[model samples]
Target: MAGQNLTTSIIIPANNEAIWISACLEAVLASERLEQAEILVVANGCTDNTVDIAERYVKLAEAKKWSMRVFDLQIGDKLHALNVGDRHATGDVRIYLDADVQVSNRVLHQIERALDREEAGWASGKLRMAAASRVSRAYGRFWSRVPFMAKSVPGSGLFAVNKAGRERWGDFPNIISDDMYVRLLFKPRERYGVPGTYVWPIAEGWRNLIKVRRRQNKGVEQIAERYGHLLKNEDKGAFDRKQIASVALAYPIGFFVYATVSLIVRFTKDQSGEAWSRGR
Candidate 1:
């Protein structure tokens, strides 16, 4: 490590994530080669045992010579929680991970090492979508095959940036998609996908899946509407026509489910974006 690369901070913004925070921290505490790391769990508007569960990790963190703190806020805003976590973070590299995401042991270290550079670099681990339901699993199968998800660093559940990269933007704005906003700040070459993987669960049922998909589309539209310039850095690439045909041909059920979901999201009345949470 050189310069400020000496330290890494993992910031997790949690809202009523008691069901998932323990697993999230457990996976994080198992990171390797990250001797001096900080874990900031911002539990906002949590009515569950999220704060309590996070607090239990203090001893474990200290045993690893790492620091862990839980900040309980009265508001349930994800962006506000991220800003608060950033203000308290003390790392040259910052990893913003969702509370419901579970990283493999090597994920944090790999992403941290990838960002050790003089130039601004953004990075994230390989995404593995986990869905328990039949419909959601089918949709995830089709969605995961898309060019943006398979080829590009989607950074759906987690994204990390070095100190220089953080300067690309100020405090997170009230945006529908913070991940999209941040990823758009850098060009494709500036983004790196580590070899490690992280498990991100998909919204389970049709209603939940539709809600999440709608929010994602709304987030993209909101970004285009508000920060039109950042679109220049987007590298989603044209859809892979061959792959689409192959997937749809091989898995007609998944294709039908995915296509129907897209159609519903497209035709249904646009609702105001719901308050963001940990996919809850």
Candidate 2:
């Protein structure tokens, strides 16, 4: 709270995240750096107790002298919820955090410091999957090395930016990859990926992973359709070809591998059952 004048607003966009809201809110409140920051929980088309959990946080914010507000939208898109929450923000700096991610005080401090610097429009950090499956670990490692490839600013699982920059870029676009759209709005130098700051979320299962990748592919296609001219000629062509090829090849290969492994496991289990019966 040393910089009381520089209030930050933490915007959380959630849908059907009742089980995770309490932990997320607690982490935000517990962050010493964010103690003075405003917390806005935007529940979009939640069919669970997400709203109730948010209300509890509001009460905590009141008692602790921190600002908190809950915005309810009947729609189910993340970008729409973000835009709705922005209207109620009273902070000079806006931070986005996903409902399921946990951020530390030290990282929050780093985010504020990064944004406080002149000419810095946005700041984000590494994302670590809390549950470290082999696939999740590999995905994180790959993304960590290729920062530019993560065009979407990442759903505030943990990111912060200046109010001025947010205004310049306007609100999150109504698209699956709104984060990427926001990143594209700014020059590469205006954004910073701080080293120490990080968020840990649950590893997405295979089913959800495929669904997300499909959505991402669709988003990429939309981006190409809308801003194809902005990309370098060769890059645009390569991107289009890659998208088609990935859709055609990746899923089938994955499915085949999964099926083979599953069949092997089932066969082994069945054999074990028969062997035990014969032994008895």
Candidate 3:
């Protein structure tokens, strides 16, 4: 593990992400000092030109001596798409990236180097929330300052692990929160956060915010019920009343939006049996 040579496999599970895939790929292709890597865009159940758009990058990737493959599937399951990427990935390091996320130029390279040691460790870039609408901007500002997000490797849209670190799991399972499931695999001490940042987009407005919040709650509940043992690795600090008061006083708009979303999601009926979409 120590002094090991590494090539990273960046897996992007995209579902009708024609709008964002190009930006994501553009950011990735602009990496600063990555020696070698492959980009696997798993275009699952895409009805648009996602596959065609991704395939256009093949030559660009070739110019860098890297390979870019788009695995077009007829099914629209993220977990299944991820497992498919794993099967065809040839790199020693594995980086899971969401289609909507745009990484800083050095993110993949930094994470790969951080996980290059022999020890079993997982790594991710710093999370930066991007919001288009006013309400979402407020919410994102509040969220970006929360204790858990500021204190830990909250890999919402991006995470990477070396070969030794990946031995902890087999194929990606059918789960509500794939990110949560993978993150809880390692102890806090084993999670590494590099200096690079990735912009994770937020939902547009109120209705979408509630939808995403509810789905996130469901994901956490699913883990708590089925993979309860992984809870030991959970280090999310409690959302104390003092912090709440401080946020409410300093940023009423953001605090109100964030609180309203949580309240609505709290009263909603469980929709775990139904299909849940993350964003609009």
- Alpha carbon lDDT of each predicted model: 0.90, 0.64, 0.90
Per-model TM values vs. the true structure: 0.96, 0.72, 0.97
Clashes of each: 0, 7, 1
- Tens digit per residue, CA lDDT, model 2, 16-46: 8887889888877877755567889999988
Highest TM-score, which number?
3
Candidate 3 scores a C-alpha RMSD against the true structure in Å of: 1.6
lDDT of 2 at 127: 61
- Candidate 3 local lDDT, residue 4: 66
Q: Residue 95, candidate 3: how far off, in angstroms? A: 0.1
lDDT of 2: 0.64
Poorly placed runs, candidate 1 (over 4 Å): 1-5, 240-242, 270-280
lDDT of 3: 0.90
User: Candidate 1 — what's its lDDT?
Assistant: 0.90
Ranked by TM-score, top first: 3, 1, 2
- Highest lDDT scorer: 1
Error of 1 at 140 (Å): 0.4
* After superposition, candidate 2 runs with Cα above 4 Å error: 1-4, 117-120, 132-156, 200-203, 228-280
- Candidate 3 per-residue C-alpha lDDT over 1-280 given as tens digits, one digit per residue, 9 for 90 to 100: 5576778899999999998999999999999888788999999999899999999898998898888898999999999999999999988889999999999998888998888888888999899999889999999888877888888889999998888888999999899899999999999999999999999998989978988888788899999999999999998988799987886788889999999999888877755565656665
